[model samples]
Target: MASVADNLTMALRKQIGAKLNVLLLRFFDQNKSGEILSRVTNDLDKITETLQTGLLKLLVAIGTIVGSLAVMFYYDVLLTIIFLVFMAICIIITRMLAGKNLKYAAFRQETLGTLTGIVEEYYTGRNVIKAYNHEKESMEQVCANTELNRKATQKADFLTNSVNPLIRLITRLSQAVIAVIAGTSMLKGTMSVGVVQAFFQYVNQTAEPLTQASYMINTIQSALASAERTFELLDSEEEIADTKTPVVLNRAKGTISFEHVSFGYDSSKLLMKDISFTVKPGQKIAVVGSTGAGKTTLINLLMRFYEVNSGKILVDGISSVDMTRQGLRQNFGMVLQDTWLFGGTIAENIAYGKPDATREEIVAAAKAAKVDYFIRTMPQGYDTMLDNEGGNLSVGQRQLLTIARVFLCNPPILILDEATSSVDTRTEKEINKAMQELMNGRTSFVIAHRLSTIRDADIILFMENGNIIEQGNHQELLIGNCETGLQA
Candidate 1:
């Protein structure tokens, strides 16, 4: 039974992990990571414990009760009937307590999930909290969550622990009444002392298991609450299924167009309405906007990270919806402001985009991105092991490694979303020089707040309130030649 329970738990964890992987980005946006993690970890542990011990104990208690009752009946049918009446009362009381136990157990789990979310948030933002001198506020918030969890847990434990003693009290009273009746029969010479003693032995046997069974049942009920939460996550909606026969784009020519594209994080309130734009092959398009002007949203739509509500995005003149997501994304290389590095050798991090890259190829890509010298200066050079997120390297160094990763892929299209924002002016100029050579024959989309960096872009798109307000080359925008109301 223990082995079966363990294997089942492992299978369930794997299934939940797989489901989370395919779920849409919207699901993640709506749910807290820590809450989801609690369901997968703590709740599953509760289920495993119940299955391994509580379930087995309950089964044994049931067998013992049955066997004891059989012997009691053979010894004296009248006494057995009386005993069963008392057992029925015990069952009714236990059923009532079990119902309350389940309610408290569910409450306990919910509070635990909330507490987990609070802790996770505070831990990740500890640096910001300290910088802003908000440590006291953070501590208070965590304490409040912890208090709620404590109350919920206390209530649930009280119910579970109280069941066994309550059932035992009822059994003891029933035994007292039975003892009186047997003693009277013995005094009247109608029942033998040996029979009376033997009957009491069976009575004890039945009562003991009844007590154990009641406690185990309550414990199992708590686990059932946890199981319900796990099932909720499994039942969450998944991403829309891929087409039966998706269009395959092996090597796109990097022509992208957004025709009447409309979208919103919430479908009812469209953020980008009837937005249309087109880009030719090998053109540099710069998207410039204030905060929350939907620059990133446009890129997200192009990459199909979030689906459009009422229009089409085309890659190489083919509707992107018809193409496999992998096929569409593989043709575009992205370097974001936030660099992500794992615990691995520097060579492995550089070769992330092209896992099978040769050592010579990795070095070449690093050199193109202007990070090869830094790599060589490290104690182990390309083989140096990086901690999580490359903690040993400065932010600029990490950004350069991510840039090198994109260089290795050499995709048909490139996306640089504040890619140079973290680096110094000298490093930024170096990256820009390398980027110019890299964008020679490939389409590129640059999302930037630093307007000077995109001065030479083939076209500039000025967006506001999710609409393209003005667009032209830098010189045209500056000279006001396109006749748009706004100028650069």
Candidate 2:
């Protein structure tokens, strides 16, 4: 019975953990990954540990205490009453400790989460810290978090450990009292030797279970603390659900338009206000701006990574909000400044956008991205396995792989966000040639840090302070700027 109950508890814990894992991606997208990892791993482990042993011990203790008490009464009613009074006192003492155990357990779990966050951050950014010669500062931060975790764990463990010894002391005292009562009754000729022996045995049995029961109280409090943290994450608000009867974007010609758009990460301050733009099918549009000029914010809105405060972003002629998110995103291909390559074969990375792509299809895309020659130089060619962080590949090589992924996808609309910025001048020229070929007949949006790259664009939107201050072909914007030495 204990084993079955324990298995059920474990299964329940796993199911809840799995649900929390999925919800974390959608609900806590802005939250740190380390905090989520701590809740799923450390917090869930505490609940499992208690359920596996503490629960079974608790149940056995209850049964033993009742059975022992009944046998004692059958042997001698007066002796049983004497033990009961002492047992009641022990119960009161254990009750007084409940709140403190809870407080410490919760504090310990919280500190563990903070410690995990520090360790994760330090490890992920170790290279950056060393590059900036801030290794000493990073180590100091790690030590600070470690010290806090140590103190909290010590307090929680001390409280839990203190319970067992106190319970044992009370049990010994109760047994001593019971022994005297049994001795007196046996000498008075009212009790036989056998009954006295049995009575003594029952007293010990009762005390042992009561001691275990007291310790179980502490186990339960600790488990509840961890469970509460897990539940808090599970209950966090999820992303906005798709509208009822959402429009499915079956196919689109890629004409894009943004009408009177307004948005801000914080509601009190507007970042992009009343923004409007249009790009006809097959047109090449370039958006150039200084840092913090809301250039990326515009792209995020187009991809629906964020919703606009007040505006309509249309793909084809349909409002983005009307379409299901998945259906809407299917029409676009994106290559961002940060190239993401997972631990897999080079071929797999290129086929990420089309998982079932044929080998020939993958090879063709690589060639178009101007990376085939490089891949051939590798000993394993397409089969070469990438390191977890792509440590084996150069920055330009990683970007080329990402571009190949988009080529195989072949969506009607394309977004290149500083796509060639990470490469050297030579590689940038080759990548730009490949990109131009890919963007030939697609409605494309280019967010460029290099003005030279977008000089030939059909339209250039030069923005400042979240508004387009100038919009025209490159020559038109440059006509007066050359004379004044100031941007139009």
- Pick by TM-score: which candidate is best? 1
lDDT of 2: 0.84
Each prediction's TM-score versus the true structure: 0.93, 0.88
Candidate 2 lDDT tens digits, 390-428: 779988889989999999999999999888888888878
- Cα lDDT tens digits, model 1, 213-288, are 9999899887899999999999998877777799999988989888999999998898998888888999999998
* lDDT at position 93, candidate 2: 74
Model 2 lDDT, residue 438, Cα: 90
Error of 2 at 141 (Å): 2.8
